[model samples]
Target: MADLYKEIGNDSDYGSINDNSSAQTEDPQTSAPSPSPMTRHQYIVFCGIALAYFADLTSFSLIAPFYPIEAKEKDLSPVMIGFVFSVFSLVQFLSSPIFGKLLPYVGAKFMFLAGSWVAAGSNLIFGVLDELEPGTQFLVFCLVTRCVGALGASASVTAATAIIAHTFPDRTGQMMGLLELFCGVGLMVGPALGGLLYSVGGYKLPFMVLGAADTLVVIINIFLIRSSEGMESKTKGSMLAVAKIPAVWVIALTCGVASTGMGFLDPTMSPHLKEQYNLSPVFISLVYILSGSAYAIATPLWGYLSDKKRITRTLIVFGLTGGGVCFLFLGPTPLFPQVPTDQVWTVIVTVGLGSLLLGCAIVPTFIDLLNTAKWYGLPDDISTQGIVSGVFNSFFSLGAFVGPTVGGVLQQHYGFPWASTMVGFMFVIMAILIVLFGFWEYQCGKGRRRPPNNDLTRQVSVNYFGSEIDDTEENRGLLS
Candidate 1:
């Protein structure tokens, strides 16, 4: 690590290593050391932040099985139950908009801590809220708690993403991919745990358990994740900065619409399986776990493909169709019993497709857009990443707010099949939007010639225990 300044800071012919020269280098001294358990500090930071992702997804997704249980406990009608799921997203929509204003001022560490407190508190509150007099008010209270907890998570998500990006700015494409990988893993494990645990216990126990886990994770996070730049005195940019970019908005909308699809199925999944095939909640929970597994497996692979400069949006188009087809056809064999008698396999493929489709394409789509946004000048830091991401996520939160309610309506009127169809259409919308935005970005990036690799642009590298993490800048967009 001789002239550390030359490698990380100097924007000379040497600092931003060209593809050709990049290939020539092999020494571990100038590159990020391969991930190993020996790197305990790095592992803790990566895992801590990643666990935060698991916390958010797990906490919110924990409701999937609990939805029916909650509805019955509070004597909630169908509409009231739908409100319970959708209301949380509504709160995310309302609160995320202003978070950008406060994030830079508070810094990512503070933001992560704040979100931890909020999430833990929300869970505690949900576990102990007063009974509502009428209209299943307690049900609404649960949604409210989820929303606030998610809002609190907003800052942490940004912090974690930015911490990685800012720390490994040159390697953001892959690093971010890794970040998503962890989050996807969290998504998988959290739901599986929740689905399994909640089925064994009841609503109150699961909420308390999730709350305790979050509190513990945060305590670890406080010491584990630290910004390379320390705390930036100020993070520049606005929610409007992202909003004003039509490309950005399109990207955001894609996520919003995509999430709407996820939200549609996530809450009502228990009911759908129960009604359609007379299945147990455990079966539904298993489906979610499998879906999450698919996502976790795909995230890192997609990120690597992005580094190779393959076509990310192209992958997305197929994902939408794949996901759409899965949802369109996904259901219990008993629902269409005459078609086939192998109920388990039928459910597996449908749920697998639904899971795989969403996993294969959805996370990458948003990550690609975020990379594009960062190249446009978004700083790689937690609060800034949070605000920028939050803007996109807020749009998604809006869609989430609407998607479940719509699904509930369709289920109320027609049934599970029709409700699932409503979810598929959202993928259709996301695919269309990706086509539009990808086209726009392609044209714009095409107008500019490829700059020399050594050109005076930023360099990103990650070092753990004084070892370097190799991240290249050429891999900017998801498909590069």
Candidate 2:
């Protein structure tokens, strides 16, 4: 156990074991310099990113509580409703990479502001959808507006991620966590606010109110965010090159798996609670709020731990394993026949705990991916960060697209209990694979000799061979 922790902790980036011979050929520009203290300018940039993230997520989730009911009133089937929701993620998944590739050429500030404006416009257009009579026209409008809104979201989110990474390279994990905290708050606030607005007016009220607020956020940021210099990279980043690395594949899967768990719950969880526990809609909303709150509250702590303690891999493994246990109880799966699924407390506790762990698992992934790619050979520039951010968003959006569609089908055919169990099994399987991979890495490290100097080369040797290399003559001997 001690050896495993040492292996994981010493090489938190999970540097590609097979690519150790390539390290000497790596671009020295890829090496991250020590991070300086935050300046007033950085704080301003962070605030802008945080507000933008909050608005993006709030608008993204705002329709959740009432959109299905409105769609049904328009005579759309459940599958059609699901399509409307899934299209957002689908467009985001496709467009994120494109925007990422363009970031170096166009600049992050331009993409961020432009995307915000587009999203705000889409929201305003969607507000008037109620005016159209229910039928094919309504469905067509829904899909078009959702696709446009998703494009805007993809641009803004991708740009924001790149900006934060470049602006605070040393604290990438912590900043990403803070942004996710805003996202969780947005998720919590969107439904409650949407339900409130829906009560006061009708279908159009929520979109109108939120759309106007989103525009307001954009206007504020226009002045608050300055164009950062030195953000554009000389070399174009290749997503294909980054994707080819095995370490990146592991990180992407970790991200996708975590998102899949969350996405699956969106459509199925409400209905399951209503059917099994007989909870009111308000109570159901509270349950979601509980989960979001847990996620929001725990995200920052996980980020702090990752940055301060360098436990990125450990958090990912722990989050997945712990989340799997929570999911089993969340359904009070038949596996645990004694646990009462009928009780409201069971749903609340398990979902909250599950989300808490989910936050821990996901918050460090961006930084982990960034460092891993750089360690393997990707340039450490704005271009590389943009590409990495794009790939990360694409995987996350892919999971979102797949999860709800599959979750809805599984819930329809099997029961929520089984559906939930399947998700649990996915988490456990991934966790086990990570552990096995770590053991294999440890075994490989055992064959290398430790060096005496314990300097920079020592760190490099540990990263590559799980052992140290002397800074002097031994370095040449090992390299040759």
Q: Point to the candidate with the largest lDDT.
A: 2
**TM-score, per-candidate, Cα-based:** 0.72, 0.86
Q: What is the lDDT of residue 346 in candidate 1?
A: 64
As for candidate 1, its clashing pairs are 31-468, 32-468, 32-469, 32-470, 159-382, 169-460, 170-460, 462-469
lDDT of 1: 0.60
Return the TM-score for candidate 2, rounded to 2 decimals. 0.86
Per residue, candidate 2 scores C-alpha lDDT tens digits across 321-359 of 999988888887888788886788878889999999988
- Model 2: residues >4 Å from true position, as ranges? 1-36, 439-443, 446-480
Per-residue lDDT of model 1, residues 402-439, tens digit only: 77777667777877766776567667777877766555
lDDT of candidates 1 onward, in order: 0.60, 0.80
RMSD in order of candidates: 8.8, 7.4
